[model samples]
Target: ETVDGPPGARTYRRTLRLPYGIGIAAVDERPGTATGGRGARPGGWLDARLHLTDPRDLTTAVQRLRRLFDLDADPYAVDARLGADLRLAPLVAARPGLRSPGTADPEELAVRALVGRDRAALLVQRYGKALDAPCGTLTHLFPEPAVLAGAEPGGTLGALTAALADGTLRLDPGADRDAATAALRALPGLDDHTVAVIRTRALGDPDVAPPGTGAPDDWRPWRSYALRHLDVAGEPQPRLARAGR
Candidate 1:
């Protein structure tokens, strides 16, 4: 969505998955000079502002944004540990600080995991709430679990939404990782692969091993990044990029 303004001042805007309440984040895409341009590589810049419904949501909002950008990770420590491994050393050398991308909304991600991209998009278009003011092509806040529960209440999507809406299964960052994984696995129709995706993306557990892939011991607490590095055959994607978001 583009916020209305003067030329060269257009801002891409969207509703966020805030803790206390729904919020809007407007991000300016224009590049800017860094603190030290000399010896600095070229990169894109974003000037972002968040408008929240409540003042108390600030802390959670900031944390979510950090997770969204994978900013809180200590890349030096992660690289030091993983770069020593024979399998990942060269990849780590090639890409100094790889990070695992996290999600802003866990429940939404869980639903998308089951329904696939096109169906998820259709679900958003069908049930999402329209913004008070539209922003270019972005106009809806992806439907919350409760909303989706009412929209679909019998199939796998319904079961997942019901679990999410009632808090029977918690996928938040603060949720207990092992317990949440178990609970998600116990849910009807949710397989190990789906649970693993939730653990990696939703819960932000960087060390989560894939369903059957064996990870080295040194990759602990950062195996998710290592898995991502392996997924690309040593060429990892940028940290800020979301996978098909």
Candidate 2:
């Protein structure tokens, strides 16, 4: 949830589900006044504060937030690499630190990928754990894999959740990307597109070229960012006659 703050500032509040218990996070953001002079770059800053029920979980919570916001990415190096391609040069110049987003909870992202937004919302409403103290419209934590598995949702969702709950498939941050991709493919009713989305976003693989985009070899290790630039430029390449790796 968001509310107006002091002039030019925006404040956001939300409840977080941590390993031990629920926590709350608040962030205040405003434009950087230091960047207003002639030839100064346009930029802003934010102050993020977290309240945890268990102080021992502080490290884990901070690490999760880093992944959620892609803060560990080395933007300068990524920009240098991707800027070499003329196709992506302009985009790189426009957004120097563009990052491929990572998930705070990989399992949650996988479930959402299997079931689109509408169905996911329904699942959340039905199975999500209510917060001890609700914050604005955010009243519940996303349903856990065990809860969804017990519900025994029909078809692909059921299979996926069961695998996640039982460890047949792992989408955790430390999971091996190739193994996770193979496991996802073995599941019935999961298409290549869905698997690719899971592998790239949920698994945090930065080099994935979705099957058939004809991504060049030069984009290696950074193809995901290149793909985003192509998509934003409305210049997606046609499916290659031979599929891409």
Candidate 3:
């Protein structure tokens, strides 16, 4: 849920499902000014605040927030490496410190990835857990894997949910990236692109270059950020140019 704020700032507030209970997460974002040239700041910064029902969950909440915002990334290093690439050089220069987003809830992201937003909304309406108090339009927590698993959504979604519910697939922040990728690959009906999406966004693997995009090998460990640069620049292909071209 979002609320209009003074001038350029926007405030978004929502209820976050925590291990103990629910917490309110709020963010106030303001777009940065363009100063022009190579060093220009292209994006905005946000201020986040969390109201937790159980203070004991503060550490977990903070960690989740960090992942959600990609705060753990070293943008300067990433920029230096990606900016050296002729194909991504201009984009890196334009949007320095740009981050590849990570999910607040891995299971939720996985479900959304498979079902798309519309079907996920329907699932939310039907199975989402109601908050004791709604935060703006955010009245329910995203349905848990156990709940959705029991709902018996058929086909790929059902299989994915069941795996998540029973721990056949682990998407938690601490889960092993390679193992999870293999597990996702083993599931029928999950294409390479979908698995890559889950690995990059849900598991927070920064190096995955989506299947068959022919991403350069040098983009290792930052391929996800490279892909984000292309996405922001609206380039369908990497189209890397020779170094001196």
Highest lDDT among the candidates is held by which one? 3
Q: List the residue pairs that clash in candidate 2.
A: none
Q: What's the true lDDT of residue 151 in model 2?
A: 94
> lDDT per residue, candidate 1, 1-245, as tens digits?
23666655666566775667777777664533446567654434347788888878888776766776577888899999888888789988876766687766778888888888899889879999877766557778889999999989987788889888998888887799898888787778878878888888888888877666666667787888888888767453223334595
Off by over 4 Å in 3: 1-8, 32-45, 239-245
True-structure lDDT of candidate 2: 0.79
lDDT of 2 by residue, 1-245 (tens): 24556765677665567888777777665454444778654553356788888987788877766776677877778888889988789988876777787766789889888899888888889999888777777777889898998896668988899999999999878889889999999999999989988888888888888777778888878888778776767876535776469
Instruction: Mark the regions of model 2 whose C-alpha exceeds 4 Å error after superposition.
Output: 1-14, 27-46, 232-238, 241-245
Name the Cα RMSD for model 2: 4.0
The residue pairs found clashing in candidate 1 are none
TM-score of 1: 0.79
lDDT of 3 by residue, 1-245 (tens): 34657766678675678988788888777577667568655555577788887998788877777787788999999999999998899999898998998877889999888889899889989999888877678788889988998896668888899999999999998899999989998888999888998999899988888766778988876999999999988988555455684
lDDT of each: 0.77, 0.79, 0.84
How much is 201 displaced in model 1, in angstroms?
Answer: 1.2
* TM-score for each candidate, following the candidate numbering: 0.79, 0.85, 0.87
Q: Is candidate 1 or candidate 3 better by TM-score?
A: 3
Q: How accurate is candidate 1 locally (lDDT)?
A: 0.77
